[model samples]
Target: MEQSGNQNITDYDLIKGSIAGDPRIQEILYQRFAPKMYAICLRYAGNNDDAQDLLQEGFIKVFRNLEKFRNEGSFEGWLRRVFVNTSIEHYRRKVHLNSISEKEEVGIEDVSVSVLDQLAERDIVQLVQELSPGYRAVFNLYVIEGYSHKEIGEILGISEGTSKSQLARAKSILQKKVAEHLGVTRK
Candidate 1:
């Protein structure tokens, strides 16, 4: 599809152009999605440097595999999944793999309330960054990305128990942070 002078190029057009090695269209796609995807990386990375690294790596993968995007779902969703998986892959590469005992994993219950909702997205991101890599990965996958422990374990190359344990620890840490922010403690 030729780029019209006045009309915004659709995502499909950019994807097609990118796959055909059109650098301008590729740049257009990158500018369109990079900001949103960077936020995803930041949530998983715990810092700007790591998030920037993941952002670059994820875009590299996206461009390399753009032809494989089957058009079955929203292109943005597909890109977000790729970035999220890329973050997990990076985490696994850096962290030691270990099995966690069942007893150590905490059970997650649906809370009637969410303090995180009260905080700005940036503040929530900062709070999540305070967690260790393992805990942060599990938390982002399970809490933010809506992955199950089993799915997270498979992605991170850990047992389901380990994923659960890490998520529990992350929640505990986050809960304390939230409590501090609220000027209260868990009863």
Candidate 2:
């Protein structure tokens, strides 16, 4: 079949085709959203491998619940939410977020603007990757994913305080990593 070069395919059309069980349309939808959604998953996942897993899992949820979308907003927004939730679900399944301690949970406020300016996007992503899974999850969820501590805790099956602690630890670790990269020592 001839593929259109990123033509403006309406969500209505895509949804119709998907509901009709047209495999080609489904593939097209996947191709369209996968790259952007994969990046979202990557931010939440601790490593590239886990990111890929979350990407697949997220896509699965997207396809499975495609019909439920109410067309009240941008399809991309709806899809993005699915991918985010999928990433959170993946973490919840793999980690006991509830087990975090107050010392382990880090608040996000400690992450400084100066530090962020010192690093590029890729550098920040790498710093996040270096964090332990629990710290990384809370950091990504709160900082990157814009989830509240309460939401992060609920998603991870941990208390809000644990999420706060994890985020703080994540910030401290990231600051150290960034400082090391910049040849600076903390006072």
Candidate 3:
């Protein structure tokens, strides 16, 4: 795992070196992916300290299970799944997903895409972070990670109805937050 004069080592080599316990290669692998992975963690964890913990836990899982990674897809894709699952596990431990009452499940108005398009990426992340854990998990899994409500229910140990409800609730709250951020009144 010695560094060649050129800094363009491939992921295959990095994986092999890391699996073989090469410290330099492990560090390189971590440096290459940590930033993007941390964003995933922050999206799920909603704060710096929890995100940091999830990131560390995710890398540990990544390194421990590196040998299980077949070369079928991009390494970063695999890494994303790991971090996202780690974040979900953390969420599960911290909060129990409960079904909202019928009275509380109001119809959600569609937030205009233009309002979302106007905000900075950080503002969007901040707004998402403000969501409660159940709402946040469902939103990230459904909207961000592209999981169906059924899949999200299986992952989060809730019913599919609950998953859909949580996502609707998350969107409703985010709609309000976006309007407030844009200083627009909702009729």
Candidate 4:
């Protein structure tokens, strides 16, 4: 596929080029989506190195499965889903979500909404990264990716209640981190 004069390349073209093993199109596809996909990977990966690994693994899967795409919806959405699932798979291998006993649960007071309002997105992402892998996985799935507790449970191999509990703890810990970052004590 030759780059025509002054016309933006469609994702269909990119996918086609990539399937044909055109390095130029593969490189173009990577250049187009890597940043957004890497951000998603970073939310689930604990650190930069792991995030890069997820990015690499995800793109590998994306290229390998590009032919499976049915053209039913957004290409970017499909790519995002692949990246998120790759991150989840990475977390799944590293940590098992052992159910926490109720007696060990910690309570956290809800902070003012302004706390999140005050923080930059990078600050919020950093706080999320500070979470343990189990908490981070649930938090990313439910909170960021908009998967429900039931869906998250199925994906992570935990019960729905456990999914909810992890999200609660993740939120609670995040609130404290945000409070500390903002120099405001949570009551």
Taking the tens digit of each residue's C-alpha lDDT, what string does model 2 give over 1-187? 2267645776777777887878988888878777899888888788889889988888777778888999999999999889888887777677765365454444335555367787888888887888887888888888877899899877887787877777777788888888998899889
Better of 1 and 2 by TM-score: 1
TM-scores for all candidates: the values are 0.87, 0.86, 0.92, 0.91
RMSD of 4: 2.9
| Model 3 spans > 4 angstroms off | 1-6, 102-114
Assess each prediction's global lDDT (C-alpha) against the native: 0.84, 0.79, 0.88, 0.86
Question: Which segments of model 2 are wrong by more than 4 Å?
Answer: 1-4, 98-113
All candidates: CA RMSD (Å): 3.3, 2.9, 2.6, 2.9
| Model 4, global lDDT | 0.86
Q: Write the per-residue lDDT of candidate 1 for residues 1-187, one digit (tens) a residue.
A: 3335514788889899999999988888888899999999999886899999999999999999999999999999999999998998898788764456666455554233278778787888998999888888888888889999999878888888787677767787787797787787688
Clashing pairs in 2: 105-165, 105-166, 106-164, 106-165, 106-166, 106-167, 106-168, 106-169, 107-168
Clashes per prediction?
A: 0, 9, 0, 0
lDDT of 1: 0.84
lDDT ranking, best first: 3, 4, 1, 2
Tell how far residue 64 is off in model 2, in angstroms: 1.4
Per-residue lDDT of model 3, residues 118-184, tens digit only:
8999999999999999999999998899999999989999877777788877888888899999999
For candidate 4, lDDT tens digit of each residue in 32-139?
A: 888999999999988999999999999999999999999988999999989988998898888888578655544433333347878899998899899999988998
Worst 10 residues of 4 by lDDT: 105-114
